[model samples]
Target: MGALDIFCYTLWILGSVTAFPFGDTLNRQAVLKTNIQTTAQFPNNTWLENIAVRANGQLLVTTIVPDAAVYQVDPTQSHEPLLVAKFPSALACFGIVELGLDEFIVTTNNWTLSTAASPPGSNSAWKIDMTTFSESSGQGAVITKVADISTATYLNGMTVLDKTAGTVLMGDATLGVIFYLDTYSGEYEVVLDDVLMKITVPGPVKLGINGVRLLGDELYFTNNNQGLFVKVPIEKDGTAKGPYEIVARFDTILDDFAFDTTGNSYVTTDPDNTVDFVTQKGSVTTVLGNKNSTLVAGATSAAFGRTFEDEGILYIPTNGGLAGPVNGTFIEGGKVMAFDTSVVA
Candidate 1:
């Protein structure tokens, strides 16, 4: 071959190797062994909604019970949450995360029993002291408000970015935007908007952004109705680059997600109903399913916690199945279930 031809061939090979997609090749699997023995049920008064872990390993959970209470469940015994605070009745707690050693924040929706398409409450977020369980209302804890956006509605999912001065990033499902809220100052700004594409399914497919997780420089989110998981690139300038790509697709409603230190992302699906764990490479395996009729109802959200003394376990909450007799309840008596990830294959 001529010298110029050989050089061109080398450049082609190099470019091909550099541009090869590496994320799709990884195999993700979540082998869920049903552990009926380890199940921890929450009290009837408290309907567990979402859960978060503190730096010290204590679990902070939000509930739908009266008094806007945030419960702290011992890592060892998650069934019984130690009641931390009983704030005002107006606070309709949705998701929660710890801000510091003795403080935390919780998100609220409108105080309504119906799941109608309505805007989330404009009530400012509240900051609570973990030590005294004292809450400061009115913009102290609100990172962002619906008023901040001319037409914003619901704030569904939230997670704390510890590296960013403890700022919390929240998903507003109603308007398809992600807001970055300053926990310390209550100032908020839109970091991501129109990032998720609406699922064009006929007859009300649950197609809005639900759960979000940050893995390295990439942000992953769930499209609940379409059962799709997507990954977006995070630029150095604190913005995300998209043409957002779908990583995995399942047959259920994807709700919430949590990642272990090993980069395995666990997802909870409702309606069609199942729980799955996906690896960083976009492969999925079912951890919990209705195959054996084991999970009495559809799984809503899940969080990982320490079991016994130091082993890791998963805590899942169920929204009773549609065909079952106990339908239409947010979380009934048989709502909470636990699995020991250390023992599951």
Candidate 2:
């Protein structure tokens, strides 16, 4: 009401914008780029846990809801996810891997800390058909019951390896172990174990392996709590070598990563987290974060499209503040965010 009060208000506004421009400012030095755009969101029944893109440009995503369905989303459509297949009595579906044309694999996390009832065998691997997205026909796109790794609590991340060997690699968040499985014979082997325990850090003990991506002969994964992107050398036999090496380290929590064709790696962090791009020479750049007006809330996972138009665009899935208290009040759930990395860096 008074002239002095008005002057003070104006100065406060200026200070706020100058100090923190974004609505949810977490990292001060990181610049939030404008090219990032939202793609889709699942509110009530759709709790998307993991995503995998097929060679035909179709996106396959798994959910944690009661029905435990796998969805196929048209890349051209906006937030429209068509339910392909639903597993009965399955609670949480975590990871997905494309096997071939109209075929894929999914890993389920039966035991969730947030839920009361747990599915039989903490985690089970299943094979599904992409065309019909069903396991019933036993002829068409069927869901073949695969191995159950009950010993591993949460089988979180998955990626397809050399198809000639019919092997797929998966990350277990509950036990911090990585397993390599033969798709044809159902044979499985542990490639890496206790990865977080092996890493020496001074902070509070946090051990969970989330995202995994295979680049050439090296396998790169994320240690969520430590905010570390680690690489392990894989032998010709498809096994990992000695201790895994830390490729890039960050202060914030990391979710998933996308590799560009040029061998550059782009990783997604928390809603208030910063983006870290690592070059082949081991250089790191913070292309997006708190410095700009664009705010990333509850960013969970990211994937790089193979096509030229979408190749460099990073597809990010957000919870949009719906997944409970962990995401916070400002951040909402069920929204997909796309960031054009080719132009940003």
Error of 2 at 14 (Å): 50
Considering every candidate listed, which one attains the maximal TM-score? 2
TM-score of each: 0.74, 0.78
* Residue-level lDDT tens digits of model 1 in 224-270: 55567776766533367655677777665677877765666778765
Q: Which lDDT values do the candidates have, in the order given? A: 0.57, 0.62
Which tens-of-lDDT digit does each residue in 28-124 have in candidate 2?
2454567876566566434556677765556677776545777766666643666677777566777887776557888875644355234436677
- Please give the lDDT score at residue 17 for candidate 2: 9
Model 1: worst 10 consecutive residues (lDDT sum) = 12-21
- TM-score quality measure for candidate 2: 0.78
- Total clashing residue pairs per candidate? 2, 13
lDDT: which candidate is best? 2
Off by over 4 Å in 1: 1-32, 36-39, 43-46, 65-68, 87-91, 116-123, 132-151, 162-164, 195-199, 236-238, 291-296, 306-308, 320-331
